[model samples]
Target: MHNFEEATSAFAKASDAISLKVNFPRTKHSAMGLKPYLTKTVWVLSVISLLTDIASEMLYPVMPLYLKSIGFSVVLIGILEGVAEAVAGLSKGYFGKFSDHSGRRAPFIRLGYSLSALSKPMMAMMVYPLWIFFARTIDRLGKGIRTGARDALLSDEATHATKGRVFGFHRSMDTAGAAIGPLLALWYLYAHPGAYRPLFLLAFIPGVLAILLSLSLKDRQPKPSGKRQLPALFSFLHYWKDSPPAYRKLLTGLLLFTLCNSSDVFLLLKVKQAGLTDTAMIGIYIFYNLVYALAAYPLGILADRLGVRKVFTGGLLIFAVVYAGMTVDGGGAWYGLLFFLYGLYAAATEGISKAWISNITDKADTATAIGTYTGFQSICTMLASSLAGWIWYRQGANTVFAVTTAGVMGVWIYFLVVLIPEQQKSPGQGG
Candidate 1:
């Protein structure tokens, strides 16, 4: 039975943490010019993310192709993506809320990576699309289970001054693994053309590594605050009610943007449409990840310096332009530029959004807030993907891209009018 004043004070702390200027105390001798400031947990989590993404990307790029090979249509692929993401979305808040009550993050993380690792074998043995769906859902379930708890753990380990850098560094490593994975997948395909089974098996190695890496992170029970008994799961709804207005506002803005941003498989399909072979398509994916990895750290630092309000808004703008470009029947250069801009937009937005949420919630509710935010956003993305698939199936690619661009534009405007003003209202935070 926490009082409203207690909640208010905690909310104020969170807002201040997120709204600090560049003049805040910074750590020198850091890994990426912000070194000695970050903790071991951040680096460890980065390693875990890197390994897990390697395993994921290894199978992911090929899965769509395999689905098509097995007589699945684009709409089916979209539905599959939507359903899988919806499962992940719904699970995140539950796991996060549970983690807050239990106050142990490592178990959920270990279990998540292990489950995903096990799923690789399922993919390797798949002879039908349902098998693929089962494997992908299992993997995404693992992702859903770990993401909230892991992110909460990172925020716990980092100081306010280092939050952006910590998340950014993690994303860079994660994207680096994404870059490496496609290369490995490409090699396997090159060496053994049309042989997907071996590639699936090879993916198992990195997933295992990710689980092992989770062992490096430490977890502890919460200090006995003598609060009322907490429910095991679904308590995050209470967390939202208790959290600050700014957090909820930011979540709404992010959700708005995500509703228009569907699963990226369609983009891959677009690249294929643009005249690249399977191998070349993979090469471009590698290129996109490289750009993402390169840009994430710098953008993260920029977020810490300049404030996330503008950087995040700028990211939405990039997405809008990229989607607009995609609507056209472009040459190679147009598609390449679109993919590259997407990479830049990801660097600017993804980690920053998590960092933003982490900065705006109570310390005790970190996992709950992050999980809730990610969960809702992902669910919206599922709906958006499903809609995009329906549109693409019926109206064609031009209409789908144009509609996406329009949706993002609307979101961008909402951020400017509503989301940004709340942050600006606080003195000392950048606009």
Candidate 2:
């Protein structure tokens, strides 16, 4: 086996060549423009994510069902998910900052993938649901650490003009894995009949594959600058003060947008309210993921071609409309349409937003910028999810949907008025 240093250097040289070839001027883009973006690095990272998501999702859908089978209460399961997500969200920023301070993205990527990969066999060893809880938290902790740093590396590798398209393609690949995972689980259960432990053990293969692939990723280091290092990681005060104006503005817009949005569980609850069978609900959920996977690259291309601003604005508007549609007793067909639209909204926002962030920040701070933005968005989204749940319980679904729609609409207008113009003037697109 090659030494790690040699493997890293080889990966970096190959990535650099691919980036240059594919990320040529958007004006010179061809019908085969995607050929360039089909870089070895991006594809490798996407495959890693694809494998990781497959491993995670195979277990994810079955987790609650498995817990209930093992006599764990719904309350405990809910607590586990809540706590795990909170830990992941809180840790993202710190890890991103670490990647920046250390000037290496690959090490953090390796460590994160290793933690999550270790989580699989741990789940297989579970005799109690509590053990599963620890396993799940460990997996989520890996997600928190790797996500920002991974995106930063992606941003670094992508050209400024094609950032949206590149991120969009990655999202497409990730969603493809999400779509495949459940089917694999379902097939496994059908073939082996109640062999949950075997299925859990099988998850380890993909997780390990993900980790091994991640080990070969190139780490981009910050150029030699003699800026004073912070005395302590917790002493982020100076860093925050020194953040670019563009990053701050972008963060404000993101916080406002995310504050209006909440967890997808609320959408699922609406499906339940509509009296859909559990099987039908699963079908719809899978269909939604498929739509998300299929639409991401095309929409990302549209973002690159027409401007991410235009596409993002349309997405926000659609979000408001979808939530508003849910406020009423729309038939099952309408609900299906809303879910499809939700997928489109995801395609519109997820990658484009990251590309947008890359556009606004200095390239050196890519990891820190992505981490801070993601960490802030995760915290606010947590609050938004809780608030939506509370309002739905206290009032009604309509009341909850109405409030969310109003908030989304408000943000849409705010974006049109303040953010979009800046984006048009910014480097991501034309003046």
Most accurate candidate by TM-score: 2
Candidate 2 backbone overlaps, count: 1
Candidate 2 regions off by >4 Å? 1-35, 128-130, 192-194, 220-238, 420-431
- Model 2 residue 100 CA deviation in Å: 1.0
Candidate 1 least-lDDT 10 residues: 422-431
User: 132-183 in candidate 2: lDDT tens per residue?
Assistant: 8888899888988898788888877666556777898899889988878888
| Tens-digit lDDT track of model 1 for 1-431 | 23644553354335435644445554342324432434566767888889888888888768878778778798898688777888898789888887777777888888988888989988778668788789889988998889889998887766555567668878998999999988888778888889887887888998888877887767855444565465655666677688778887888788888889987878888878877777677767788899999788777777776787778889999998988888778766777788899999999999988888877667677888889988888878777877888999999888889999998999888888884332323433321
Candidate 1 clashes between residue pairs 3 or more apart in a chain or in different chains: 30-35, 30-36, 31-35
lDDT of each: 0.79, 0.77
Give me the overall lDDT of model 2.
0.77
